[model samples]
Target: MTLDVDEIERLYAYPATERPWVRTNFVSTLDGAATGTDGRSGTLGGDTDTRVFALLRSLSDVIVVGAGTARDEAYADYEVDTDLRGRLGLSPIPAMALISRRLDIPQHLLVADNLVVTTADADPARLATLRESVEVIAVGDGEIDWPDVLTIFADRGWTRVLCEGGPSLHGELVAHDLVDELCLTIAPILAAGGAPRISHGAHTVDQQMRLAHAIEADGGLLTRWVRDRDR
Candidate 1:
């Protein structure tokens, strides 16, 4: 059954919390492949997933992504939907934050008004060029200290953080215990080709998650998992 706008909003809505909520949204195939032959998650999602993706973006205050995903996905500057912003009482279009130590971001993305959350040892020359268009924040020496990144986001009042992953970033978030919820869409497609799973990294931590809800549409399954804080 196709979900209406109101129903979709109700399904993905977050409750009033004392602190910022961090959520990660991803799409995968039935075979546990996070990508397809094209090496992008976009190929795995269906029409229903698209609606959910847009809704997640509209509801978020900031969109956090790994630099690799940002480059591979060819991210564009987020456009402000004034009508939705007014209705939601949001300040502006959600800001995009790219995390990278290389500072090797898409050229057009750098020109757009965004934030580069990088480390201190990032290439100075590349950062100099990016600085012309984007704001740069140095949080670590080589690897990004996830905790510091969360603190920075919270300090800026960007509490509703939405992470669109390339896996490694999601792994880091999971390892640091920064992920509060996960919205995963299981595409109906059965991908036999080799691909990474939703979360990939050397740093692994066993954390239990509770299924908050699950919905079916267009033969695909959209599921939300909230961290079992008691675990």
Candidate 2:
């Protein structure tokens, strides 16, 4: 079924209150992908998928992205809809959270309520510099601890999080059993050589997910899955 704006909005809106977290992970084909491999995801999906993506971002309290994705996509803070915020019982804008092992971030890219999650052993100077621009959070015991990171977000009242990933980070989350839901958009075109596949994580068939739903968007397939409870 082709997704429409009302359906997209309703899907996101319903999940915001029922689910604690929702992660949207996607990858594009070769031959200059995701908006022509020049590196933009704007053209990757159709109008419906685009609206769905925007709604997903809008309903999230925090948009969690890997540092690599942030750099490659030239990420920026999304303007929040006050009406949506009131409906979801959220503040004006959602926080933009970046997960980076190093402190190598550009000062100009810092958003007003941006956050950097790094290891406790990260360079002091880098931490200080980031503090000058946005919130700097140190989690784990000198490593990027996933458990600690979740606890940190939980402590900060971020129950609903949207992780827009770039493979490696998604693999890490999958490996750690941290992902509760997966929303994948599969384009009709294939990139047999250029970009990597949707997931590179190591998992047995027992780790397979159960399909919750699927929709046709922009001639491609958008599938949602939930981890098998029996697994």
Candidate 3:
């Protein structure tokens, strides 16, 4: 049951709030693996997930992604549909916010709206080079202070935040109480490899989530889970 653009928007509209509303979107296999054998999450999703993926990007001002995942998933493509964003009245392209501790980003992606979110613990020489090409955001001296990052995003009017995770980053966001929702698509594949789950970190917090809705489409289960604000 593939949905048209309007229905997709109706299903996953960002909450109307002043602060940053964080939502991490991912597609996983039935076996709980977030990727297929080829080491890419894209292989686990189908047409419906692709459509929703586009809508998620079309609705956000910036895409927060781990530098590793950005490289593994070829996010240098920016994965944005500019025309779709235009018709939906969103920014022509969501800024690609690549978080890297070492400041190891591809040279070609070091232009335009590619924001390098890192820390003071990174390599100084590399940071100098990256700063020359794009804006560099360092919110933490030892680690990434996600709360401050959110504040910066809000200050820039990029309140609708979409986190495309490589697990650790998503886990940090969850542990920080910064995530508002998770839009997960369960692909019907039993990937029995060692791919990590959707979110993991050195530390974790147990926050209750409400299963907002689940829709079956394109041989996958599209689910929306919102953080239970009362919890």
Candidate 4:
């Protein structure tokens, strides 16, 4: 099926109770992918794709992205259309979350309700800065604790967390069995090498997900899947 912008928007607009936690993951071809050969995801995806992506962001209560993704994507403020928020049954804006060992976040990307999950052993000064900018939560004893991180979000009323990944984060989430749903956007073009693949985790075929749906968008494909419960 072709998942146009309207359909994608409707998918997100469905009641949160129907789809509590949705994680959207995407990876473009290598060789400066996501953009044309230039290097921007917006360029590669058409208008419909962009609209779908934006709607997904709007519907999510919290948008989780790795530090590398934030830096690479040059992440900016998340703005949702006033009318769209009502349509999607969402808050005015979704909180931005960054998972990193250190507290090296850009000032401009900082929002009112930013969340930083780091290790207890991180630099004290950096922790102070992060706390001043947004809500800082110390998770694990080491660099970062996955379980603690999840607990922190759970405490913050994030019942339906949306993770937007850059591979490494996706690997960690999948490894810890923290992901409930996976929404992947697969672009048609293939580049030889500049970025990593969709997932970096070490999972056998049996451990992989079963497709829930496969929909074409632009020239690419968007695949949604749910993890095997028995696994």
Report the candidate with higher TM-score, 1 versus 4.
Answer: 1
Candidate 3 local lDDT, 75-140, one digit each (tens): 656466677678767777888899999787877778877899998677888888888889999878
Candidate 2 lDDT over 65-104, as tens digits, reads 8888788777764665678778768877778778888877
Query: Which has the greatest TM-score?
Result: 3
Alpha-carbon shift of residue 12 in model 1 (angstroms): 1.1
Query: What's the true lDDT of residue 231 in model 4?
Result: 21
Residue-wise C-alpha lDDT for candidate 1, range 12-123, written one tens digit per residue: 8865665668899999899899888898899788898988888888887788899889888778765544676568786667888888878888877775557999887888
* Candidate 4 residue-wise lDDT, 1-231, digit = tens: 455556776665433443335475564642435334555454556555576677777667788888877887889876776576677566677788887876777777666677877788888898887777688777667647866666666676665677888677877777777676777666777665464665566663335677977777777766677765632
Off by over 4 Å in 4: 1-6, 12-22, 30-36, 87-89, 201-206
Q: Count the backbone clashes (under 3 Å) in each candidate.
A: 0, 2, 0, 2
Span of 10 residues, lowest total lDDT, candidate 3:
75-84
Q: What are the models' TM-scores?
A: 0.93, 0.85, 0.94, 0.83
Ranking by lDDT: 3, 1, 2, 4
Best by lDDT: 3
> Candidates ranked by TM-score, best first?
3, 1, 2, 4
Q: Is candidate 1 or candidate 3 better by lDDT?
A: 3
RMSD of each: 1.9, 3.3, 1.9, 3.4
Model 3 TM-score on a 0 to 1 scale: 0.94
